[model samples]
Target chain A: MLDVEGLAKATGAGGKEKIKIQRQITLPWVEAVRISVRNVTIRLGRTMITASGIVLGIAFLSSVWTSGVIQDGLQQARFEQERELVAATTRDQAKPDGGKTEDSAAVPGEEKQAQNSKRIWLVVMSLLVCGVGITNAMLMSVTERFREIGTMKCLGALDSFIVRLFLIEAIALGVLGSVLGTLLGHLAMLGIFALRERSLSVAAKMDWGQMLTYLLLCILIGTVLSLVSAIAPAVRAARMRPAVALQTEI
Target chain B: MAKIECPECGEQIETTGIVTVCPKCGADLREVMEAVGHERDERMKTIVRDDSVTTHEFIVRTRDLKKIYVMGEIEVPALRDVDLDVRRGEYLSIMGPSGSGKSTLFNMIGGLDKPTAGRCFIEEVDMAQLDAFELAWLRCRKIGYIFQTFNLIPVMTAMENITLPMIFAGMSTDEMMDRGRELLDMVGLGDRLDHKPYELSGGQQQRVAVARALANSPAIVLADEPTGNLDLHTGKEIIDLLKELNQASGVTVISATHDLKMIDVSDRVVHIRDGEIERIEHRADIDLEVGGMGEE
Candidate 1:
C-alpha cells in the first residue's frame, strides 16, 4: 500500500511539504444494517420481547380497521335485502315499512360514528404504551452493553455509528411486530364476521384494495414509531464516555 | 460572584463576571484561566489538526498535565503537573500505588479524558485540540487499547469482534474478513473464530481482545492492567504475547500496571507515587526487589 502522507503531499500545492488528508468515519449504510440484523438474531428472545409491545398496539389498530370494513359491507348488504323484501310485499302490506326502514338506518349510522370515536381513543392509548415499552427496552439494551459500547468507542466508532446501530435494531423490531399484527388482526376479524353473519359473501364484497393500503399504512406507522422511540436511547449510548467502560461491570 | 486575594501586589479583588486582570498589579490571569479550560475566546473552539502545534520525536508526550475533581466545596487533585515522554517502539510500564494517578495518566495519553490544566500529544498532534469525533478518528487509526475487563462485544463472534474496527476504517467486507482471519491466526485463535465471548475462556477472550485492538494496525497499543484478572500462567502468556508483538511489529506498547512481571518485558519502567513520577529505570538497571505496586 502507498503511504497516505506521501499521497497527501503529492496532492499539495507545488507537490511538496503539505500533507492534508484526514480519515473520515465512512461506515456504510448496508454494513450497519447487516450488523443490526445479526445483533437482532443473536438476541432474538429479547428482540421478540421488545417487539411484542409493537405487536399489541398494531393489532388493536388493524382490528378496528378490519371491523370498520366489515360493518360497512354488512350494513349495505342488509339494507339492500330489506328494501327488496319490502318492495315484494308492498302491494299487499301497509306502507308504514317505508318510515321504519328510514329510522333503523339513521339510528345505526349515528351509533357507528360513536363507536368509531371510542376505537380511535383506544388506538391512541395503546400506541402511547408501546412507545414507552420500546424506549424502556432500548434503554436497557444500552446500559447492559456498557463494556461493549466502551470497546467500540476505544476501537474508534463515531457517535453517529453507535446511534445508527440502535435505531436499526428498534426499527427491525417495529417492522416484525407490525407485519405479524396486521395478519393476526385481519384473520381474527374475518373469523368473527364469518361466525356471526354466516355470510362469507359479504366478506367477499369487501374492498381488497383498501385492506392492502391499510396494511402498508400500518407498516409505515410501525417503522416511524420505532425510530422515534429509539432516538433517546441511541443518543445516550453514543454519549457514554469511553472511560466508563473500563471501570464498569467487569 | 467570587472574591479572591490576588497573589501579586497583595490586592483584594471582588468580581462579578470573568476577571482576567488584577487591579493593583495588572497581573494577567488569562493564562491561568486558559489552563483551567475557562477561556471565553476562539481558542475554546479551535481544534489543532496539524502535528506541528506540539513538539515531536516521542510518540506520546504530556506537559504539566493536571486533573482535579470537584465535589461541592471539596477539590481532589488526581494528577499534579505530570511531565512524561514515551519514545517510539519502546515497551514502557507505569507502576504506581492506588490513587497515584496511574490510570489518569494512562487515559490522558490514550486521549480518553480532559485535563484541568495541561496538554497531551500523540504523534505530535495536540490531544487537547481535537473534539470528541476527531479524537475518535485519531484513536481508531493510531492507538489500540486493551482493557483489564476483556471487553469484547458479547454477542459477536471472535472474528466479528476482530473485524469491527476495520468496518469503521472503510474497508470492504472482503478485506475485513481477510484481515480478521489473519489477525485471529496471529493471535492463535484461528480455530475459535466462530466462538462468542461467553464461549471462550478468560485467556482466549483476552486474545480476541488483542486481535481486535490490532485490527487497524495502529501505531501504539495501550494496555490498562492486562493481567489484572488472569491466573499466573494465563497472565504470563498474555504478557509474553504483548512482548512478542512489541518486538515483532515495532508498535509502541504502554501498560499501566502494578504487575512487577511486566517489568521483565518492558524496555523502561517508570515508578510514580503521590501523583508524581518517583523514578525511571531501564530494564537493565531496575532494582528487581520490588513486587507489583498499585491498585488501579
Candidate 2:
C-alpha cells in the first residue's frame, strides 16, 4: 500500500496530515546472498588475488596438521619395531646358553618434541602472514568500491546492509581459499610421506577423523580471519555520509 | 475519488469533483487555489494550505538549515541558514557557481546529510529526529537521486541498476523486473536493458540513471548537475526527457545545476551565492532570451 501513489498523496497534503502507513522494506536473505555472489563473480580476478593469501595460510596449516599425523604414524611403527626387538631378546635369554641381552630402546621423546615445536612455529608464521594479506586485500576492496558504496547509500541501502555485503563477500572467498589450501596441504603431505617412507600406505595408516577435523579447523580459521579483516573497512564505509561519498572522484 | 482539505477551515472533505466552497466555513477554496497559483486538477487536489495553521505548504521545508564541516582544527561552513520550500508537483532549480553550497542544500533536502544548526522537514517529518534506519526508509521511499556522474554500478546491467532501489525496498523479483522494464521503456532504453554502464554512451547512461531514479516512484527526484557531464546536444535531450517525465507524471523535481538550459525548464529558479540564497526567479519572470547571466 505504501507505493508511489501513497507517497504522492502524503507529500501533496503538504506535510500537515499524518498518513499511518508501514513503509519499511525488509531486504530478503536470498537477495543479499545473490548480490554478494554476483559481486564476487564480477570481480573474480581481484577476489582471487585477495584470496591467494588465505589459500597459502590454510595450505601451510594443512601441511602442519598432515605432518603431525605422519609423525604419529612413524612413532607407532618405531614402537612396534622396538617391541619386536625386545621380544627377540627375551626369547634369547630363555635359551639354554642364556645369551647376554642387548638393550633395544625406542628413540628419545625429546627429539620428537623438538620436531613438533618446529612444525608449530611454521604454522604460526603462516597464519600471521595470512592475516596480513587478508587485511590488506579487504582494505583495498573498500577503497576501490567507494563510489559504488556511495551510490548504494544514495539508493537507501542501510548501514547494516553494507556490513552484511562485505561480510558475505569475505565469507565466500574464505570458503573457497580454505578448500583449495586444504587440498594442496593434503597433496604436500602425501609427497612428504612418499619421500620419507617410499610408500603411500603411511597416509592410510593415519586417523581419518582427526585429519578431517584439522581441515575443518583450517576452514574455520580462514573464515574468521576474513571476517575480522573486513570489519574495519565495512564500518568505515557505512559511516560515510552520502554527500561526501558522492564527491569522491573514483 | 478526490480528497481535498479546506484551507480556511480545518476539515477533511471528500468530493467527486473540484469543490468551490468549504461546506463548513463557506470560504472560497477556489480563491485560495488562485492565490497559490494552483490549477484545478487532480495534481492540485491535496495542496491545501491554511495561513492560520502555519503548516508547511511545501513538500520539502527547511528552516535556518546550516552545515559546517570540521576538518582537524578548522571549521568549514558548507551551508548557511538555507530556508527553502519545494511545492508539490513543481520543478525547482537551484543555480549557483561551483562551491556556492547548492549541492549541499540538495543533499540536505535529499536526507543524505544532516544540518548543523537547523531543521529539515520532508512531508512534515523532522529529518534530524529520525534514526539511521528511519532516515534510510525516508531516503528509500521519499527521495530519488540522479547524480552528475551517472553513478551506475559498472558491473550491473541497466535493468539491474534500475531495480537496485526496488530490491532495497523489499519488492519481489517479479515486481522489480516489471517496474524496471517499464521504466526502461519510458526512458527509451528498452533494448538496452542488458547493457552494462561501460557499453552505453554517456547520454544513454544518464537516461538509465533517470529511469533508475524513478524506480521507487519517489515523491521528490533530486538531480545534481544531471547534464554536467553530457555534451550540448545530449544535455538538451536529457533535459527534454526530464521535462516530459515531469509533465507526464507530475512528480516534484529539484535540481542543482549551472546549465542555463536546465534552468529554463524549471518552474522557479533559486539563485544561491556564498552559501546563501540571493534571489528566486519564477518561470514568468525569467528572461530566456538573455542567454547567460550568472553562469560561471
Candidate 3:
C-alpha cells in the first residue's frame, strides 16, 4: 500500500499545475455515429416500426413511378402502332382522312392526363403519411429517452451530440427503409406485369435504367422526409435542461 | 517503524507510509487515512491561500443561490439564498428530507442547473459566465455524477457503460478500455465486464455507475442518494467503495444523502430543512453514534 495521503501532500502544491497540463479531449464524429447505431440496435423494434412506415410509403411511390414509366412506354408503342394504322387507313382514304387522324391522337392524350393526375395523388398521399409517421415515432423516441438524454448531458455530451445522434439514427433508418421499399416496389411491378401478360417474360420489357432512377428518387425522398421529421424532436431533446430531463419518468 | 491502531478492529498494526488495510482484522484503513489526509490538505490550502493573497481555498462556492420553479400559475421556491463552500479533496455530505432542496443544491454545484439569482463557482470559474459549450467542456473534464438509480444505459455492458464518458471525452479506444478495466477492477467487478445492467444486481449496477463516473478522472464526484436503491448491507458496501475511491484518488466527493452510513464517513455534514441550511457539522465536533453535535 503506497502512502496515498503522503503522495497527495507531497504533490498538492503542484497538482494545479499538473491539471493544467492534462490534454483536453474532444469526441470524434465517428464515435457519435457508433453510439447512434448502438442506440438503434437496442431499440430495434421501435426503429423498425418507424422504418416500416417509410418502407410502405416509398414502396407506393416507387411502384407508381415504375408503373407510370412502363405504362408510358407501352402507350408510346401503342401510339406508334396506331399512327401506322392511321397512316395506312389515310393512304387508303387519301382523298378524305385528316379529321380522323386528329381524333385518334387527342383521345390518348386525354387518357394520359387522367392517369398522370391519379399517380400524382398517390405519390402525394404516401409522402404525407410517411412524414406524419416519422414525426410521431421520433417524438416518442425523444420522450422515451429523456433520462438517457439527461445522463448523456451530465456526462458532458454537447447539444450537438444529441442532435447528431437522433439524426444519424433517422438517416440509417431512412436508407434501410428506402432500399427495402425499392425492392418491394420492383417485386410489385413484376407481379402486376405477370398478371397482365399471363407470363413472367413481360418483366423483360421493363427498362432497368428507368427502374433504377425511380428507386434512387424514392431513396432520396425517404432520406429527406426522415431528416425533416427528426429535426423537431432532435432540437427539442437538445434544448432540454438536464435537471428537468433527469426528473422525467419513462 | 511506525504503528497505528485500526479504526474498525482497534488492533495495533505496523505501518509504512499509507496503510490500505489492517493486518490484524483485514479491515480497510483507507477511509481513516483519507480523513487524516483531508484535514492536512485543508490546512495546506489555507496556508497557500493566505500566502498567495489570491485564489479562493474553496473548490466550489455558492453565493446567495436561489432557484424558483414556476409551474403554470404556481411558483415553487426550491432554494432560498443558500451560501456554501466545499474544500478540495473533502468528503462533504448534504442531508435533508424529501423536498428539502438538497438535490437542487447538488445540481447547482454540479453545473447541471442554473440558479435564478445567485452565482456558483466551480474550481474558481463562475458557471454563469460559461457558454453552453464551455459548460459542457467543464462538465466533461471536471465533474462526475452518480445517481440513486445508477443511470447506466440498460443496453450496454458494464465495460461499455464505464467507457462511455471516456468516449465522449474523445479518449482513444485502447486508452478508454485500459482505464475502463482499471475502474471496473477498482470497483470489484473485474469479471463482470460483459454483463449488462439488467443482468447485474442492484449493488453491482451501482458499482458500474461508480466506475462510469470516475472514467474521466473528474475533479469532483457528485452523488445524489447513490445507495438509495440498495439494501442496507449493499448500501454500506457502496459507501465503503466510494470512501475508498475518495481516499485513493484524492477526488472531492460531495453527496446528497440521507443514509447514516454515508454521513458517517463525510468530513462535514450540511443539514437542510425548508430549502434553507439548518447547520453544518464538522466530523470532529459530531458524535457518530448519536448523529448530533453541540452548538459551536
Best by TM-score: 3
Off by over 4 Å in 3: A1-25, A80-102, B1-56, B288-296
The two-chain DockQ for each candidate, comma-separated, is 0.22, 0.25, 0.26
True contacts kept of each: 0.54, 0.58, 0.47
- Which residue runs does candidate 2 get wrong by more than 4 Å? A1-23, A85-108, A196-199, B1-56, B287-296
Writing each residue's lDDT as its tens digit, candidate 3 over B1-296 gives 12456898899764433458988789888777666555434532321121112233466777789999899999999999998878777789999998999999999998888899987867656678667877787777778899999999877899998888888788889988888887786666878999999999998899898888877777788999998899997888788767766666567899999988876789889998888999988887665564432322
Winner on DockQ (1 vs 3):
3
Q: What lDDT tens digits, residue by residue, belong to model 2 across residues B153-248?
A: 988999999998999888888989888887786566778889999999998999999888888887778899999999987888788667656665
How would you encode candidate 1's per-residue C-alpha lDDT over A121-239 as one tens digit per residue? 86777667666665676677767776677778888898888888888987887788888877777788888888887867757867778877877877778778878878886787688
lDDT of 1 by residue, B155-211 (tens): 889999988888888888898888888777666677888999999999889889887
For each candidate in turn, the interface RMSD (Å) is 7.3, 6.7, 7.7
Ranking by TM-score: 3, 2, 1
Q: What residue pairs are clashing in model 2?
A: none
Output DockQ, candidate 2.
0.25
RMSD of each: 19.2, 12.6, 8.5
